[model samples]
Target: MTSTMKPSYAIGVDVGATKIAAAWVELSTGQLGPVLRIPTRRDAPGEEIVADIISLALAIELPDNPDSALLLGVGVAVPELVDLHGTIRSQWNFPLPHLLDRLEAALSVPARAESDVRVAALAEARFGAGRDCDNFVYFSLGSGMSYTLCLNGKPYSGSHGFAIHFASSELAVPAQDRSALVAAIPEDYASGLGMVRLWQERGGFPLAQGIHTLEALAAQGNACAQNVIADAAGMGGRLIAQIVNMLDPEKIILGGGLGCSTGTYRTGLETEIRAHIWEQSCTNIPLVMAGLDENAGVIGAALAAAPPG
Candidate 1:
């Protein structure tokens, strides 16, 4: 209220497989109020999840007045494919038949939803690492893996709004002897779950359940843990190199829980990416870590409902 620019607020919700996080965000400056998080009811009924999202949105306290005119609608980042019409086209963690519609009807305000990865890319484009680039690829290495193309400060939602699915690509480690290719899903080796599974398969450590656990073991000088992390990062990097060779984007912005960290994974991925790049000149392309932390998805979700200037 003290600033020259008018203040606008939107409630952003990130509905992940494990947790649902909600926050009140100032759209103009991308500043978030205190965040509220709760475990997601992944196996619960669809209506319960929708109700929980609405409950989280309503809990955000607004300034001046709780029901002020400065408050915009709610935006949600879902863990599934969302079409142009704000409809979740596929079932991922759970089935939500009509999510946005229910939210809007219950809250008596407009609501918009998009794929979580794409929403994160939009947040980066507007307020994070991709802001300076005209075209960038937001490569997310999380519990699962995916990516989004940010073009001119906007995320490119494909025809059906399901374009980014890089994790599904069947790729293989290059064979030195030119033998037959053995293709595997990249996520099974590079993603958080993938890394854990890979660790178990290779008999690294029986107790490593998540990627963070592996990181901790690696820090403690565990050779198997370190090798698993490095190998996964290398595969991730090689895939990124392929992206560079094809799109040649202005920048590659890394996001997600795993990609944003500055650890062995980061070093290994960068080295592998440079080695696999088809063009020598392209190898120098910047790989910027996303500026926002865990808040990126919520901030981005709110941006979807922010009023246009």
Candidate 2:
């Protein structure tokens, strides 16, 4: 019997600070199979991590028939600074140059790397919430915060390929002592870490609860949790509103564990965004949660490695 599977599939790897996830993407249908995740050996040498990534990609099951299935290439998404050629310049203090070279030699297939947020934006543009829009801004608010501006369905990586590093942009917030000035970045007030910091600052009960648990607690009417989340959401909204005002994107897609949740946080975020939007016409700009969720990064890597026909 003739196999119905496509002739080739792309492997996508998402390398995060805590874990590395990989999957095989069917080129013809854009379907992603089960993801294989391994705890990231962040402390290990960069070369070792690269080897792990390559091995994981090679181990993924392709189509049953050898003649019917081929490994197209590999795409990697890393939480680091990457150049246009997929070279990791620097991030997390790991030696990435050697790793990049080793990956290419070991894989024997075209390998492309990109910033994780950029890859996620690519995935959303092709298959998720941004599929119908040519221009949109993708915000990833997790342990870190980043945003990618997509124009004409392509991510705008500035001259240095660091256009999305909004976390470093300074923002003025009240000092902890309330007697002096404090300057903080968006990530300090808008990401998972920021939420936890806010909770701690506000002296929330059960201080051990993580961001997810805090969300649950907030849902249960915990005032401290609510305040922490609300503050973060509001700040996040202001940052997003700034992006909207500058780019005028048709939509703003929010991703990451905390950003995608539906409820008070999102409501508060949207409320602040609406309040800050300057243009009357921009008031209707859609602010939607990411549809692809966790798979977005890997799928995006695959899409970047092998552009759709």
Candidate 3:
């Protein structure tokens, strides 16, 4: 690690349901290279996806040597449960294992991977909303949902790296023949994707328009879509309130595809949380937007290799 030597350059990637993004960074300078993006091959399977990822990596021409970059290692933020050495078990949407195998075989460098949501949480802890405090939680709501807890400056990966999967507003089913009770919960009222689906099914709007962007609908003030958004926010509030009750995180940051758009939903969500949290005022929890924004996943995944202390 000589000062005169050029800083080590590492590649950073974020693979999600929406996109597969990659970057080259100078670890020593905290300087990130130009970021690149490509639509995720939705439900893309196996080797083709890997080849697609490698192809994207090659698509970029960094300021420095690309061939030498891998020696510094590549860090990937993937959507599924990844093992300590970067083996993915299963992902709800699109998934894969041994991403490192492809990179190593193609280029010959150590690679690492972790859940995209958890990586985003890591980014928040290191340089974003959770900057000052440890033992905080980063929650995200979108097509899929999850939350990550950073305790004592380290991201909480859970026993099996699946902590966030349970926080979903839709999946928290009651035990036994308690269908009636589960139905009463707000989660059944909305999940991000469910809301969009409901607009077409129950709400009656020309929603099936080939429009892919959430922004496209948000701009029109489409009342039906608005209702769906509010409903989804309310559902999130319940899950958030419960996390506050159990962990007492110092800061609660929102993130993910929906996190950025949540300014559109928070007022409703805050109102719902205030009404439901049992000891609300006594427990002061701050719900702030993620400062790191969309890049949290890639940045956090990199930190997984050197997560916040």
Which candidate's TM-score is highest?
1
Question: Model 3: clashing residue pairs?
Answer: none
TM-score of each candidate structure, all chains considered together: 0.90, 0.88, 0.83
Per-residue lDDT over 70-151 for candidate 3, one digit per residue giving the tens place of the 0 to 100 score: 3366778876776555567776676564567787676555677778878888777667788788678887766667778888
lDDT tens per residue, model 2, 16-120: 876789998876656897899998888888778777887887677765665677777888888888887777777653555566556668777788888999999
Candidates ranked by lDDT: 1, 2, 3
Q: What TM-score number comes out for model 3?
A: 0.83
Who wins the lDDT comparison?
A: 1
Judged by TM-score relative to the true structure, which candidate is superior, 2 or 3? 2
Residue pairs clashing, model 1: none
Query: How far is 284's C-alpha from truth in model 1 (Å)?
Result: 1.6
What would the per-residue lDDT of candidate 1 be over residues 162-249, giving only the tens digit for each residue?
8878877686766777786777898888888788888889876566347778888888999988999888888788888988898999
lDDT by candidate, in order shown: 0.85, 0.82, 0.68
Question: What are the runs in model 2 whose C-alpha is more than 4 Å off?
Answer: 1-6, 43-48, 93-97, 173-181, 204-209
In model 1, the runs with Cα more than 4 Å from the true position are 1-6, 67-69, 172-181, 204-209, 307-309
Query: For candidate 2, what's the RMSD?
Result: 3.2
